[model samples]
Structure formats: structure tokens, C-alpha cells
Target: MDRNLGMDFVRATEAAALSSGRWVGKGDRHAVDQAACEAMRRTLGDIDMKGVVVIGEGERDEAPMLYIGEELGTGNGYAVQIAVDPVEGTNLVATGQPGAISVVAAAIEGEGKLLRAPDIYMDKLVVGPAAKGAVDITLPPRMNLKVIAKSLGKEVQDLTVGMLDRPRHEQLIREIRQAGARIRLVSDGDLSLALEALDPQGEIDVLMGIGGAPEGVLSAAAALCMGGEIQARLVFRNEQERERAKQLLGTEDVDRVLTMEDLAWGNVVFAATGITGGNLLGGVRYTGWGAITHSVVMRSRSGTIRWLETHHHFHHDPRY
Candidate 1:
């Protein structure tokens, strides 16, 4: 893929964020998600790539646009695989909460190993560069936390693990607390938390427990760029989901642990724009005539991370 494609990915995310940011605090999640998805599709249409939506909103019947297997971009550039979450935390944006983001990840057509992640739950463990080889998903939460703490030159009691605050994670949360690690329970958007753990200066020490498999792959792309680590295993909730996984992946053995390279390999690019305020990036700020968007774009080949604060003149920008 062309190096310039990284910035083009950022533009798509920025358009999604800017479009959905308008619906913040509207208490309508479906509307906000639809707005973001539409904006992302529109922006992606202008880019120069023959892209396939490997991971996206859902299957063709579930979503109106940006669905799995959907083709995007101008078809004049290199062929690539795209993974996108137009509004990662729709509930957050709807309730006027924070940590909502528009994220996209891409890999050159035949060069990268893009995981065709099924729309199901996945167990994930993410850590920063310092603890890259120290933590393991197969280990218990307490044991993993101990190893991570040792790597970071801290005690287990000082480590903080971020995860979703859901009923399914009740036992996982208990185990972490028993292991003497502090917990940051978020209502949604574990991908942002995973990325935060990959930042050395960030507050999160690790991200664990179950999340969307597609989000896991997207997070893995960013983690690979940062020299971080993510270990994931698909968790088939039932027989139907398992059968769907087999049909999608062409296998019944769903117990394989996917490393960062397995999720997103080769020269990968990741881009994310904040729609609401959070730890990694600030939310969109609306001025009288324009809005400012905060986004981060990273590439694995060059290990380049760019933080952009763009000023969008709403009157001049027809996309918004």
C-alpha cells in the first residue's frame, strides 16, 4: 500500500467522528451509529484503494452500509483489506459520555494477514511494550497481573486492569481484585482501553476479558504499530455462533490463540478519531463556525505515530 494511505484512513475516521459528534447526548444510539457509518462510507469512497471490508458493522443483511464483504474506495489504487468501527462506543456518544471513537485499520491486499473476525465475543489480553512478553492469556488474571507488574517495576497491588463492566465479567473482575490489582470498569469501548494500555504514559496497565472480535483485530493493528502485544481467542457463546464461525473461518477448532501478527500482519495502518473525551484522545470541540478533531494515525512498517488536531470549517467542508 502507498504510505499516503495512512493519512487517507485518518480522513475517513475524522469524517465519521465529526459527523457523529453532532448527535452527542441525543440519547439515540442507532441514529448516531448510522450517521457515523454513512460519513465513513462517504469518505472512504473518495480514497484511492480497491478495498474490501473484511471487518465492519455486520453482515450484508444486518447493516445498510459498510457491511462485511462490502467494497470501498476508488478502485484505482492498491487492493487492501479494511476493518472499521465508525462509532466504537455508540452508547457513550448517545448518553453524552466519553471514550467514543471512530476507528479504521487496513492492510495491503495480499501482504497482510487480516483476520476475518466473526461478529462474536472474544477473550483478549493486551499489554504495553514494557510488558509485551511478560503477560499471557492462558494464565490466570492474578498470575498475568503479577508478571506484568514485575515487568513494569511495580507490585501487583499497584497494577490496574481495564475491562468491561458487564455481568459476564463478574468472575473475571473478582479474580483481578483477588490478585491485588486495581480495576477500571468501563461501560463500553474496550478497544480504546486496550490502546491506552499500549501507551507507556497511560494509566491502564492491562486490558483483559471479553470484547468484540472485530474490535480485537482492530486493536491488534494499533498494538502491532506500537510494539505492544495482544493475545486473543474467539469465544463461541453457543452452537449457532460456533457454526457461524466455522462457516466464516472454514474450521471448527476455534480455540486457537491469535497473536498480534495473526490478527494484522505485514505493513498495517491504524487510524482513530475521538468523538467524545477520553484517556487517549480528546473529544471533538465545536467552535462557532468550525470544529476541531483529535486523531492518531499509526503505521507498522515505519513505526510512525501521528497525532493530528484538525480544524474543520463546517461551511467549507461539504462532507460535514
Candidate 2:
């Protein structure tokens, strides 16, 4: 469906400003997330839209804002399904790191399904189309890396991979080191990390790590639109979380690898407005006198991704 793509930037910027800061460590992630939610809610109020939360902060009653099944938009246009991460890297923002962003994607409602992601960790691997079927998450990380290396006609050491900069990634990191492969460790945010994996020419060959299941789902949605292969499996740490997941998914099978089509099915449109400077999208630019927002509006139906950097000027209200 054709909707107002340009105005989506207004909402994106609002989400970004609410939670801009160094919010790393055990600091209140809720505040940053809340900022994005509030902005999203308010921004939705201004548009004639009907959308469902496919991927959100949490389920109903669990997360006060942006819960699954929560209705958004002004309720006047075609219904759409929205998956949002107001601040993809709360820790990065809190710690003043690069690549922090307020990310969101939307698809036609009913055609899209929100993933009842398990609270437990999910192992994720992504590669471009050329390397499709070359890597498998079922194998050990080293073996998978080797396959990817062979597919790209490069040594494992020449392949640059993206990883999270956390102690939990110690073994994964060590294995890569032992293999003589280089690793690009990110302090926070995996949304861009996942995107990086899709662009081999961009220097990031693959993305292998354990991250939030919801994020894994969102990345799958984006990759679905971008033509990449991603495999994910739930890795629960406790029975309670597993049971909760099973109950939500309405199935006992937690070990499933979701493809791009599985993440975002049918027709969808993705709108992203940059709140901070980074690759894939540019940061919000201020001209001192006013502000100009840069954005990329995409439609899956047409496979057209347009780069738009628009300027919005604000001056004092004119009162007669």
C-alpha cells in the first residue's frame, strides 16, 4: 500500500531525540525505550494510519509501551504491521558510541506476523546472496566461517566479521582468533551489524553472534527485504523462559531457522529516518537555523529503495 513515507521521518526523529545519550551498562534502559515509544505513539497520532506491533518492546502488560497487538497510527488508512526498536543500541547511546539508532520497519497488516520471541538468547548468522547456502549455523562457528571463506574465494583470515563486544562472546572471539580471521567487535547495536553482513563489499563478510530473539526477528525482516540468508535458533537458559516462549509461540519447537520470507511475508514497506550519523543512513542534520532530516524509504512490492535527504525549517510562530 502507498502511504505517506516522507512524514515517517518526523516520528523517527522524535524517537531519536527522546533517548540520545550514553545509556550503557545497568543504567535504566526503560527510559531510553520509553522515549522511543512515546515519540512513536505521538507521531502515529498525527498520521492517518492503522498498524499493529509485529515486533515490539514486549508483550501486553509486560512492556508499558509498544507492546505486541497494540494498535498504532491514526486509524484512518490501510492497516500495517510495525516492528520498531526506538533505540537499537541503548548501551551504545548511553556510552556515546557510534551506530546507535532508532530503527523501525512496517509491513501490510495481516500479511505480517509478530514473532513471539523467546527471552532466551538466539544464535544468528547472516551472509549475502553470493554466499547463500555456504554457511550453516548447525555447524560449529569455525566450520561455518570456513565455508563462508571458501565461498568468497578468500582465506578465513582475509574475511572481516562483525561481533558483539561482550565477554559472553569470548569463545566465539577466541575461535576466530585461532582461525586467524579478523573480527570487528561492536560495543552496542546489532541491527546495523546484521545489515553489514549483507554487504560483502562494505567490508563486513558475516555476522555471527547471540542476541535478543526480537532483534533477530527484526533483522530477518530487513534481510527478507534485502535478499540475504539468515538462520536463527533459540537458546534458552532456563525452563521458565522456554515455557513462556513455547506458550507464546503455541508450539514446543523452539529450534527453527527463520528465512527472510519467514520474517516479513507478503507486501511491505520499510521507512527509516536517521537520528544519528552512521552507515546505511545519515544522521539528522541541523542548519543552526533549522533542521534537515535524511531518510531512506523502501517498498518491497517494487524493490525500490529511495535515498531522500530532506530539509525542514522551523522559525518562530507568526502571530498576527
Candidate 3:
């Protein structure tokens, strides 16, 4: 894939963020998601690549666009596998809460590049580059926090773990609190929190919990780009998901610890733009001149991470 493809993906995410930004406080998650997906899909038509949707919004039956198996992008260029989350935190955006983002991650199309997982929950444990080899998701959260704290030269009490605030994580939260580590809970967007774990000198030290398997793949791509680490295992909620995993993995054994590479490997590019203000990237802000959007673009092949603040003049930018 061309090294410049990362910037093109950023433009797509930026378009999604801008389109969805207008619907904030509309109290309509479907509207938020649809606006983002349509904007991203339209913007992608201008990119110079032929992409197959290995992971995306949902299955063809569930979403109108950017769904699984949907072909993406345009122009005479490279073939790639794309996984996108146009509105990562749909509830946040619809409710006018903070920390919503539009994300896109792609790998060179091949068997070993991106895992083709169903829309199931995935248990994830992510850490920064410094503690990549230190923590293990199979171990207890307390123990992993200890190893992470040691790797960072800090005490367990000084470390902060971030995760989604869900009923399933009640015990996980209790255990982390028992270990004397701080916890920051969010309503949505664990993918952003996973990247926050890699933010240099960022507030969050680690991200742990179950989230969308596809989102895990996207986060893993960014983690690989920035030298961070994310490990995941699919968590089947029912027999249907279990059967789906079997069909995808070619076996009945659905439980296996997946490394970062197993999630998203080989020359990968990741791009995200915040729709609402958050830690990783600032939300879209309207100015008298135009609108300013904050975005992060990364490519694993070149080991590059670029944070961009783009100014879009609605008059000139037809997409807006």
C-alpha cells in the first residue's frame, strides 16, 4: 500500500466526524451512525485504493453502508482490508456527551493481515510500548496492573486503568480497585481509551475489558503503528455467535488469545477524528472562518504518527 494512504483515510474520518457533528444532541443514535457512515463512504470513493470490508459497521443485513463485505474506495491503486467505525460512540454523539470519534484502519489485503471476526464481544487488554511484554490478559487484572506498574516505574496506586462502564465489568472494576489502582470509566468508545493507553505521558496507563471485536482490530492497528500492544479473545454471548466464530475460524474452538498482530498485521494504516471533545483528539470546533477538526493518522510500515488539525471551509469543502 502507498505510504500516503494514511492521509486519505484521515480525510474520510474527518468527513465522517464533520457530518456527524451536526447531529449532536439530536438524541438519535441511528441518525448519528447513518450520517457518519454515508459521509465516510462518500469520501472513500475518492481514495486511490480498492478495499474489501473485512470488518466494519455491521453485516449487510444490519447496516445500509460501510457494512461487512462491502467494497470500499476508488482509483487504480492497492488492494486492502478495511475495518471502520464511523461513529465509535453513537450514544455519546446523540446525547451530546464527549469522547466520540470516527475511526478507519486498513491492512494490505491478505490472509494474515486482518482477522475476519463476527460482530461479537472481545475481551481486550492493552498497554503502552513500555509495558507491551509485561502484562497478560489471561492473568488477573490486579496482577497485570502490578506488572504494568513495575514496567512504568510506578506503584500500582499511581496507575490508572480505563474501560467501558458496563454491568459485565463490575467484578473487573472491583478487582482493579482492590489492587489499589485508579479506574476511569466511560460510557462508550473503548477504542479511543485503548489508544489513550499509548498516549505519551497520558492520563490512562492501561485499557482492559470487553468491546466490539471489530473495534479491537482497529485499535490493534493503531497500537501496532505506535508500538503499543493489544491482546484480545472473542467472547461469545450466545450459541449464534459461537457458531459464527466457528465458521469464521474454521473450527469449533472459538476461544483463543489473539495477539496484536493476529488482530491487524502487516503494513497497516489507521486514522481517526474526534467528533466531540476528548483526550485523544479534540472535537470539531466551528470558527468564524470555518470548522477545525483534530485527527490522528498512523502507518505501521513507516512507524509514523501524525496529529493533524484541519480547517474546513464549508463553502469550499463540498463534502461538508
Candidate 4:
């Protein structure tokens, strides 16, 4: 994969963030998501690559654009597989909360291994490099917390776990509390929280519980670049979802654990731009003549992370 392509990926995220940032706190999640999806699709077409959407917003019937199997980019460069979330936290953006982001991950086709995650719920466990070999998705929540705490050379009480605040997580949350570990319950955007655990300066020590399987793949790309770890398994709530999973994965074994390599492997690029600030990156700041965007771009091949702060002059460029 070309190193310069990483910057182009950032540009796509920045465009999506700039377009969706305006709708923050507007209480219209659909509008915000649509704005981001449109911006991302348009910007991605300008990049010089033959891209296939391995994991995306949804199937062609569910989403208007950026759907799975959709071809992106101009037909002029390297062939790649893409995973994207134009708006990671639509509710957060709608309610004027934090942790909304525009994310993209890419791997060179035929060279890298990319998972086509089914559009279903997935139970996930994530830890940073320090605790990579300690946590396991198959273990009980309390046991995994203990292992991670020990790996970090801290007591269970000193570790903090981040999880989505949903009804399905009640049992998981109780187990974490029983283990004497602190918890941060977020309204949405588990992807950002998962990435936050990779940063030593961040407060989140681990991310647990269920989230979108597509987001799990996106998080795996970032984890691969940061030397973090992710373990996930698909969950089917009913027969309809189970049938859908069988069709997508071409198998009946939904109990299998998906590791980082199973999600995203080989040389990969991950990029994200913040729409609302929280732990990982700052939100977009608007000025009189232009707006500033903050983003992170990383490559798994080199284990290199780049923080980009770009100033977009809307007046100078009609594209904005």
C-alpha cells in the first residue's frame, strides 16, 4: 500500500465531519447522518483507487449510499477494501452530546484480509497493548476485568471500563461493578471509546459489551495500528437475525470468536475525524472564514500514527 494514501483517507473523514458538524444539537439524526453519508461518498470518489465496500452503512436495500459491495473511488489506482462509518454516533450528534465521529478504514485488496461483518449485534471486548494477551471475549466479565487489571499492574478498583448504556448491558455492567472496577457508561460511540483505551494518556482502560459488528471491524483496524487487541462474536436476537447472519457469513456457526486478524489484517489504513469532542480527538471548531478539523490517521504496516489538524477555508474552496 502507498503511504501517501493515508492522507487521502483523512481528507475523506474531514469532509464528512465538516458536513455533519453543522447539524450537531439540531435533534435531527437522520439529517445529520444523510449529510455525512453524502459528503463521504462524494469525497471518496475523488481519491485515486479502485475501492470495494467490505463493511459499510448497510446492505443496498437498507442504505441509500455507501452500502456493502458498493464500489468507491476513481478506477485508476490500487484495488482496496473499505470499511466506513460516516457518522458513528448519530444520537450523540442529534442530542448535542459528545463522541460523534467520521471514520474510514482501508486495506489493499488481495493482499490484506478484511472481514465482511454481518449487520448484526456483536459482543466485544477490547484492551490496549498492555493487556492485549490478558482479556478474552469468551470469559466472564468479572474474570476478564481481573485479568486486565492484573496485566496493567493495578488493582481491579483502579481500572476503568467503558461500555454503551443500553438495557442489554445490565448484566455486564453489574459484573464489572461486582469486580470493583470503575465504569464509564456512554450513550453511543463505542468506536471512539475503544480507541481511547489504546492511548496511555486516556482514562478508559478497556471497552466491553455489544455494539455494531461493522463498527467492530473499524475498531479492529485502529487496534491493529496501535498494537491493541479486540475479540468479538456475533449475537443473534431472533431467528430472523440468525437467518440473515447465515446468509452473510455463509455459515451457521455464529459462536466463533473473531480476533484482530479475523477482522482486519495485513497492511491497513484507518482514519477518523471528530464531529464532537470527547476523549480521543477534539471536535471541529468553526471560525469566521473557515473551520478547523482534527483527525487521526494510522497505518498497521508501519505502526505509525499521525494527528492532523487541518484548516479548511470554505470561501476559498467552493467544495465546502
Off by over 4 Å in 4: 60-65, 318-320
Q: Which residue pairs in candidate 2 collide?
A: 21-93, 22-93, 22-94, 22-95, 23-94
**lDDT (10s digit) by residue, model 2, range 1-320:** 56454336335544454334323333566765666567666675555678767677765324345777778767887777777776777655555456766666776666655464654577888887668877778888789888888888989889888878878899989888888889998877777788778755557888888887778877776566566678877878788778887887788776676666555666666555555566665655567675655555555566666666665555631000
- TM-score per prediction, in order, is 0.96, 0.85, 0.96, 0.96
Worst lDDT window (10 residues) for model 1? 57-66
Decide which is better by TM-score, 2 or 4.
4
Q: How far is 236's C-alpha from truth in model 3 (Å)?
A: 1.1
Candidate 3 scores a C-alpha RMSD against the true structure in Å of 1.7
Candidate 1 has an lDDT of: 0.89
| Candidate 1 TM-score to native | 0.96
lDDT of 3 by residue, 73-140 (tens): 77468888888889889889999999999998888866338778788899999899999888788999
Q: Report the alpha-carbon TM-score of model 3 versus the true structure.
A: 0.96
Which residue pairs of candidate 1 clash? none
What is candidate 3's CA lDDT for residue 132?
89
Could you say which candidate leads in TM-score? 1
Q: In candidate 2, residue 130 scores what lDDT?
A: 69
Residue-wise C-alpha lDDT for candidate 4, range 59-130, written one tens digit per residue: 632434488888999988999999999989988888889899999999998778678888888888889999
lDDT of 1 at 184: 97
Instruction: Find the candidate with the highest lDDT and give its number.
Output: 1
The parts of candidate 3 lying over 4 Å away from their true place are 60-65, 110-112, 318-320
Q: Extract clashing residue pairs from model 4.
A: none
